[model samples]
Target: MTDRAKGWLVDLRPDERWDDEACCGDLPAEETRMADRLCDSASAATYIRARSVIRRGLAGLLGEPPAEIRLASEVGGRPVLPDHPDWYVSWSRSKSLLLLAARYGEPVGVDLEVIRPISPAAGVLRTVYPRTAELGAVDQSETFFTAWTLLEAAVKATGRGLARGARDVWLYRPSGESRCALGGIRNAGEVPWSGRTEQFAVPGSSTRVMTAVVTKGFTDPIHVDAWQLPDRPPSPVTAAAPRRLLRKEVSA
Candidate 1:
């Protein structure tokens, strides 16, 4: 199905297992090799887990075991979807939670932060967040992280490494906890289109949370499913933001 027809926004549980073979079965050796090559063990594991979750979700919808999807990339390091060429796939993870957004050719991006607090990353923030100067003074960790994730998500959406010039990109924050739309940088490409950002409490975990940014051309319907171990208290921070989208149609 095309992304514009409205599909799913899957929120995978860090602890539950699905019956789909595409997810639970053994992955090809090359896939495992790529994970092994990741810079950090924790990040690699998170990546593997997110891929599994996406495979399982896709299997259920396609009514067949998903095919082997490899993580190939261009010289610039952007992940290529050779198997699912028609779909745009973007995922992000923080701590135990994993977020996924799939849509049409329009680049899609998703990001989550373990809501607690982190010491500002020195001058890095100022370097990447030129718009922060216009944001006035703000000392809250959430404020900093919110802006940080937005820019990060935008870069991820562009498939450009965060170093390409994050400071040039800007996000318009209309309110402290309200949704902000992605826009262009003063001397950079605006990355074309719209997006939404929302926060959710970590289910059954008192010490964490998440925020997601899904960019323009995601005309697909939005669905968010939260999972938790049995008998755990429900997390009350689930939220979603979807916008009407029109994507450029390219010939096959």
Candidate 2:
């Protein structure tokens, strides 16, 4: 098996050419569905930036532009590339950032969350994060967000969203480079999802942000590049910026 088959995680920055502003415009129908679910401007902007990068990156891999691509939503509402079936793709973003990950022909899902400090009401921790309690009892506030991202990635990979239930998927803190398979998600029960983490330093400062990806095994040493979006602060990307989620024959 080639390295590409093994899958990979890439880190992209603003200096990269793929982050063109012209890429942003109207949201595809599928994305509008996702956008409607979000309530925050930061969330909306992040989604837009991520969508643009994913589309452009995939197009570049296919040697084409975003306009030439076509995407269809599965019954579950996840986006897929009409030209490619074997491949899986996902993107995510946060304040001043974006992330994308893809596997040649594998199911892929990615998520990024800014670790902001938060203190919730009593019983809230147990109701929302049951697994956190099993992690040997530590500071919930510090570990809450990290664990949250892992769950988000797993559910996104499953493509059922909250409808399948977030509690069905679980993750443990990383003890080694090898990631663990948590709970049953959609078709794959306790599927061993491979993943990687990225920490980016904000421009002109030392502030750092984190993002992560969960995907099927791939043989490729995932190629990572960057694009300077005209609107958002410089962020990172994996694969060519995605246009319409999953695509079969990516050009450029």
Q: What is the lDDT of candidate 1?
A: 0.51
- Candidate 1 on 14-63: residue-level lDDT in tens? 33453222232324445545655666544554555565666544444333
Candidate 1: misplaced stretches above 4 Å? 2-26, 32-48, 58-64, 121-124, 175-181, 185-192, 228-252
TM-score of each: 0.68, 0.63
List runs of model 2 lying over 4 Å from the truth: 1-21, 24-50, 121-129, 138-142, 174-191, 205-207, 221-252
Judging by TM-score against the true structure, name the best candidate. Answer: 1
Per-residue accuracy of model 2 over 48-164 as CA lDDT, tens digit each: 555666665555444445544566777776668778776666766665566666567667666776655556512444565555555443344335544555666766777867445
In model 1, what is the error at residue 8, expressed in angstroms?
Answer: 7.5
Query: Clashes per prediction?
Result: 3, 38
* Model 1 error, position 69 (Å): 2.4
